[model samples]
Target: MSTDGASVHFSELVNRNRRTLARLEGSRSLLLRRRDGEDLVLTTASRAEQDRTVVSAATRMLLAMARREPGSMELLLDLLPDAFPWVRFLPETDLHAFAVELVDTMRAADSVGNNASVAQLLVEWQHTAEVHSDPELLAALTTDHGEDYGPVPDPREVA
Candidate 1:
């Protein structure tokens, strides 16, 4: 009938279908997707389905900011490779998605100039990432929080 009504219907359909979707690589966002160029489901979750960790409010805010202004995503990406060294804890397959979300959170937190809050979240995120991803996290813990990382292995060692 009306465009608003049509839009509502489309959104509902997308949310419905999305729920049934396996989240592909097992990661999902509260984003709607289209199948055959139409809405397919109604959203049930507030954040992306992730493995190894829960998405925090800070992270969600970051994703929202990225959706609102794609350029903002760059700000989040800049701090990534170094900030979340715990990334070594995550399974290699899941690191990409985790990094993307982690950086997004950083950008959003940074946007409001809440230096204290942002710093806190960054520290926590790093802690979690390091705990879950890095195999050496235990060593660091046992070694009394020393962070003297050595070097990355050659690509061949990754397998």
Candidate 2:
């Protein structure tokens, strides 16, 4: 099966189930695009399980390497900029912190058979880098105002 899966409209699943399944004959997965909701992936259960197993083992190995070798973590930190170009905006200390957090989060998420936390962590750190890239925003955030504005509201409530 091809790893570069085919895309199909969400309605195809209901309107032409056989055609949709046929597309999967040459593809490892199918992307079901939705207009009002998040897109979905259709793949064989075995494939999904295999993917989880591979991710879990890779994350575990990476964590073990970082823990056993003194220079492994440093090597990983050095390579982060190439993997995530936005990380260049972060200071040296923050960059190191991000790398450590990322590996740890990936391992934890893999252990639980979920990648959502890893994705969230990456997005959060990228946003931090974005703020650091903006001099004015960085200055404003770092600056301490003498007066307390008010109590911070809950994000859920604000939303």
Candidate 3:
């Protein structure tokens, strides 16, 4: 058996399977089926990688919801801590991006008669941009930056 690129020979998976491979040890067995052939690979990521993946998915869903539901963006922003606890674990940049996306989605909805369709389009754009974005860059000009509401202090710091 041999391996190349981001793949491994099927035999490697078989050997690991025989040894009782466990994803809990930072590895996941993925069966790759293709027109040419099939192969199995072991995918691994650190705990931080796993956490970021989970957080990103949840954040996407929350963004989608905020876009889809009228006025829900503000509601989510108002009750972010209570309603979406996973948000607390997100990086400051991610938190900032989420807020920006929610606001953009809302603005995009304003001109369209069918706001739902506009919201759907915004979500699709978001998903597409996620594929192209650098994982470390929090905000890029990927989608519209929406509008500017001027500066404000951190809500927690405000007296």
Candidate 4:
């Protein structure tokens, strides 16, 4: 076969394989051959999968930044309010924990295939903060461990 004909045949084979794989596995991968004997595998992610990956990466990066730069925690809280309503009311010191919670909530939403649920959860947190003037109450709701971090041993209690 001519070079041009061979190229067209290869292209058609690849496209057909990709569609078949997607139908059978819910994902498609392409194997690329290299001259040096190394092959590369490329895979496709669905929109929801992409969003979940991005959010997880961003949350981890933001948490690292806040830990390394104390000022960044405040900056993150300031910036997140517009997109994440709960951030506006959470104390700067609670940013790390709040961010952790937010990421978990986002992951849960992603699992349920509800992209809009994140926004709804943030708004609900905002309203709860507004209505509850007590700092302890808010902290309980926002922190990793609801009202208690862990059960305090009876001996650790101060008289």
**How many residue pairs of model 2 clash at the backbone?**
0
Task: Compose the digit string of candidate 1's lDDT tens values, residues 83-149.
Answer: 6555555565545565565555556555563445556755676666666655576566557555657
Task: Write out the backbone clash pairs for model 4.
Answer: none
lDDT of each: 0.51, 0.89, 0.54, 0.57
Give a tens-digit lDDT track for model 3, residues 1-159: 232333434554456754434432434434433445755445455644674566556555666777787787667666755744555655556655666665565454443423474457546645544544455453454465787788987999987
Model 4, 20-44: lDDT tens digits are: 4454344344454445555544445
Top candidate when judged by lDDT against the true structure: 2
Report the alpha-carbon TM-score of model 2 versus the true structure.
0.86
What are the TM-scores, per candidate, against the unseen true structure? Answer: 0.27, 0.86, 0.25, 0.34
User: In candidate 2, how many Å is residue 126 off?
Assistant: 0.6
Name the runs in model 4 displaced over 4 angstroms. Answer: 1-45, 85-124, 130-159
